[model samples]
Target: MTSAALPPSASVTVRVPAKINLELLVGPPGADGYHPLATVFHAVNLFDEVTVTAAEEWGLSVSGPQSLGVPVDGTNLAAKAAQALAERAGVDEPVHIAIRKDIPVAGGMAGGSADAAATLVACDHLWGLGTTKQELEEIAGGLGSDVAFLLSGGTAMGSGRGEILAPVLARGTYHWVLALSEGGLSTPAVYAECDRLRGSVAVPDPVPTPEMMQALRSGDARALGAALQNDLQAAALSLMPALTDVIDAGLEFGAVGGIVSGSGPTVAFLCEDTESALDLAVALTASGAVQDVRRATGPAHGAHVIGGPRPG
Candidate 1:
């Protein structure tokens, strides 16, 4: 039996979950544009599905509520994944990739990264390339920072521009209330702002705190909430100053802890349990400080096949 999910037919569909950074420590940008990162990534229930079908020419389409402004061309990360896989396998035939997005676009949830990871899995199965997990991760590394984490799912520590991965000892599921924004913040812009805020201060290398690691290991919700940290939080707040009100509302509504999700606009509120998440979601939605409110459980599975591996 193959360890990897197999494609049953001409088309392969894969579902991938969105990711949130539980702890994000970003260092100054090196010679390369990317900032050094030490982050704890947790996949959430929010998902996007990508289906790939063999086609004479390359094509892509995006649908679902958050598909607006998404590129359906080569520029799309999904397309890049497929093309890269094809190049790796020396296959020239093209496959059309269709993405059904439920994850928020550019919402600091790594929606695009999830789609890219799904496409990689789907196309690999479609072509019967027999790509190993390590090989796939190598391809994913170039696609985006969060792409590699989405491929493995669960909880992991990411370094080296968030491409390098190491598993974390996360013990249990975590409840969260996400205050999503209608408009997205550009990650690059947020990084620029972070740099601007730092000004001339010498940036120190980043490391995940032992307290945060201990909380995840112990599966203590309150401890995790208290330990939640994101270096990008201040930058995100600067970009969307109104986000302060959202954070305030989450805490006011009894969230154990609240911080900007990754970049800007979306704020994550940690709750004690599902009951707390439900109440926080309702309160955040009613507060009018956020565009939308979503409750998600974290440590969800990463990209995996949910469709057929039909009899060939």
Candidate 2:
């Protein structure tokens, strides 16, 4: 087996994007399934930059607006990726990671997953492991359901507990306006809320059919906008009742449709274009229901190689 060796003072920088679920359908309860889901994810330009470097020992240092609750030790997914790679490659070298967070943590933006993907990519290059993108994605998938998407980046369909992926043809930039929340809503908690809401309604439905995927490919803004749906919205609204007004406010300001980004709290508002997105951002920032607002675009590429050496 190969081993990872990190030279002291080695460092690399990586930029990773947040994700938006374009469409999500909830399925019936399984033995373990809160509900099987069908989701189309779009990686946005909004990102958290991570700098990894070699140190005397393994450690993590996170800085930025959204670092709270993020683990700096082995518990962090970035650290976990480093350890996993070390074991897999049979390398013993310490790594030091510094995450400069731009993506909102726990805001349903896949900030942690992005960091993990960046770590895997940066560490591989830093150690001269020459691990392929596919190999990195496989390891990332092991890290979490959303981890692979972080590696893949861009527009893609997620199914089978959101691990399986089919890259979609979302060309041209799709603009977005994100409403930041005060804190995060737990994924498990959101799923549980869906289950609880499901108990009150009829049995959950099956995942969306291929037609929905075709709709995204058609790229008609209205068609895509009309087709956008989320199984988790009920749970998200249940957890944060105020989200209802947030959605309404976004629509009132001329957004096509607004939905919770992933689990809860953060809401992604689909806009007509980049100009409209900026306008919405300005307006939504003043809206009382949110913390901050950001403009983003989709059909964007997933994680990519940067010119720098890997961080430790």
Candidate 3:
């Protein structure tokens, strides 16, 4: 369905959730240098906000805990998303984008991808493009692999460099304790390390385990925790050994399962319930095993408008 047409002075705001990989099985690198993946993505309550307003020239700004590292120029994914949508809609008028981030930067939580997804939705609404959901998804895929998933947050299976998606049935919420690191891990560097580590070994096709799916369907956190896995964990740990300490600490604090969220640095611990998550967060914070400890629940809704159009 189409939204009401917005005036040239109208603005739109969208909120997008950060994602963690419950399972990230990676195969050998393809000709394109990207490893094939079989992954289950879970969107957490952590979010980044993007607001778009009509402007004379395309401009961008960021403000939040992690904003210092985010680019405000064309290099930013949000700006790229806006340009892509403008080209598709054949509108030359520019937009001003403002971002407020809570998701950790370069923590493998797809924070940039979340902003990109939010920009696409906000701009489409602001410009009254009336783009279909499928159209937006197609655009999202071009922006990045994880961007598509950010467009429809929840539990889902990702394949083909993580762009192709199939929604998985997830029964209930899962509590998580995220241990944020002081520094970010480069995604490309982690992938290269994975390739280097597996130099001669014949890699098998990545596949998701049935046990994990069953646990999700049953809403059993412990079972799901036992099934949590990430092929990139070894490489991530190799690059940043300090993460090992964080993982150990989380488990010691009574986490059922813990894994590097995606590529590196940030570690996510699965807790049995809300109370357990709070306890874990408190312990992790007090122990100083990480830079910061935050609690979140999954699966959260995808990129969605949180502010209505108002006269400029």
For all predicted structures, in order, the TM-scores are 0.95, 0.93, 0.96
Q: Choose the strongest candidate by TM-score.
A: 3
Q: Per-residue lDDT of 19-61 in model 3, one digit per residue for the tens?
A: 9999999999888788999999999999999999887778999
Ranking of all candidate structures by their lDDT, best first? 3, 1, 2
Model 2: per-residue Cα lDDT at residue 206: 56
lDDT of each: 0.88, 0.80, 0.91
Stretches of model 3 off by over 4 angstroms after superposition? 1-9, 310-312
Better of 1 and 2 by TM-score: 1
Residue pairs in collision within model 1: 8-309, 8-310
Please give the lDDT score at residue 218 for candidate 3.
91
Q: What tens-digit string does per-residue lDDT give for candidate 1 at 209-290?
A: 9999999999988999999899999998888888888888899999998878788578888899999899889988887888
Give a tens-digit lDDT track for model 2, residues 58-171.
889999988888887788988898888878877777778888888888888888889998888877877788887777777887888888888878888888767778877665
Judged by whole-model lDDT over C-alpha atoms, candidate 1 comes out at: 0.88
Extract clashing residue pairs from model 3. Answer: none
Q: Would you give me the overall lDDT of model 3? A: 0.91
